[model samples]
Target: MSTHRPLRIVFAGTPEFAADHLAALLNSDHEVVAVYTQPDRKAGRGKKLQPSAVKQLALEHAIAVEQPEKLNTALAQQQLAEYRPDVMVVVAYGLLLPEPILTTPKYGCINVHGSLLPRWRGAAPIQRSIWAGDEASGVAVMQMEKGLDTGPVLHVERCAIDAQETSASLYKKLAQLGPRALVTTLDDIESYRERAEVQNHDAATYAKKLSKDEGKIDWSDATQLERNVRAFNPWPFAWFELPGGKPGQRTVKVHQASVSQTDHRSAPGTIIDCSPAGITVACSQGALTLHSLQLPGKKPLPVSDLLNGYATTFAIGVNLTNVD
Candidate 1:
């Protein structure tokens, strides 16, 4: 692609979130000189080596793709110098950029972070936002520095967090919004108004990458909503233990849930009522209506499906609690 003043851009990203911005850049008027992505790693049950979404897109676009083990190496630095890019656009690149790589691009690097800066500043911003019940969250395009997501904001596009929004859904929204903000900011490069706010480290909290164990739903300790059954949907699914029978008693995973403030109360995790409407369970503060669930080795099915032939022999007022 030729232009009046072509920009030599180095693109760095890994996942689908980054891929969205990359697609925008490729279709833009600028020249993308090189693409940087994380090394291919084993994925799926077979553990076959799989390239990232960004890497796959780069291949289709016929752009030179680099999968370096680390960027700090002398070899990596030399390869980057060859491109001589004017600006580096980074989105969830996975690996941290040291001073050498950050300063290589003439205009420094710009990052597309999922959350509004000064809050949810670390990994897993999208998931954490829903868990915390934040009213709003969005994407931040920042001037990249050595500090972790502590760069000066170049532009931002805010979006409201719906009551029933999940990490998967919110991620798609932010991914698209990010590129729009990037394009707008680049359009008025000289006259763009930058809003750089210092993050309050005291008020800041980290959302560590989730583990499989985090999916286990502790009905006894968690409020109906705080358990966040929907937030954990499709990933680490919220699970609860069922009564033991013989060896290897099965457990149930609550795939979907509904929230309500009911005066009816019992021990947490106790099944208060079950009907065609839903399976109502007592919670720490209020009652939770379980709409969908899954048994071990079975697909997720609606509460009505489970009730048809696999009727739960849940007794009223039975205090049910799951222990590790």
Candidate 2:
């Protein structure tokens, strides 16, 4: 049992990352007085309404849920003020807290950010870290302030980035790491506040939200292409284009890949070998072994599986390019 009195916390988050932290708070000594999440969104092929991960979890726990479109509104401000929260715990909450909301809580608002502060400090830290080929990435608990993620750090927990780690996988790791850091910081909030240090703004690099165009592979640099394979998985996944007979291009999504040691002078994107080993495409610097891939409107399959059926598409001498 905890010796300290429970802190009154107002939790704000939207995605699974944020929801996981909320879950941690629910299991901890702190009392999450209320939960705030983004409004329901239309998702999937059916385009049906779906509540955010945080909203779903908050409903399950019977916590009072708030889904104001914007917190800056007078009504929204009044609604939160009623909670009289001691502190606000924010994770991947999409909306920025206004000055009113930020100042409402006694201790202000604190965030469970995805990266070690003063590094990748924007909307998409997990993907950016892996895209930059960072050896390690971690979570940071910080006293939230105005600038992007430019808050003073309270606590940080680093984790090694595996050789083949993807955004989907690394995100899960950080999601689990973030809550523990928040819990420890909340355990003794004052000490962390006093110990926090201002971030070096000069060293800060923003990790902008990814786009589908960024997933196009540039095979000139094996290293960069390899990083793209891992960094973009599960969203804007690394992709290439194959000419479809007479006209149009067949889009293929790379599911899993690795840097190959095959020494080749062929032009980038040239299919030099395709066998049970994998589909080896000669790049400008080296080669890429595509183990798994997804043809448009088809399920992900290993190269061996494709060889048995789509052999013509993976045939040697074929060039996969983004151009028509």
Residue pairs with clashing backbones, model 2: none
Q: Which tens-of-lDDT digit does each residue in 1-324 have in candidate 1?
A: 112345678999999889999999888877888999999999999999999999999999999999898899888988998999988889999998989999988777888888888688888888888888888999988888888888777788999988778778888889889999876665554444334555566666676787767876666434535446756766787776666643345667777787755666577878788876777778776777788888777888898878886665555555457433
lDDT per residue as tens, model 2, 1-324: 333568999999999888899999999999999999999999999999999999999999999999888988999999999999999999888898888888899989999888878898988899999999999999989888877888899899999999989999999899889889999889988888888988989999899999998998877787788899899999999998776543433778998988899888788989998997799998989899899999877899998887898898788988887346
User: Which model scores highest in TM-score?
Assistant: 2
Q: Which residue runs of candidate 1 sit more than 4 Å off their true CA positions?
A: 1-6, 193-203, 220-227, 245-251, 313-324
Per-candidate Cα lDDT values, in order, are: 0.79, 0.89
Q: Which predicted model would earn the best lDDT? A: 2
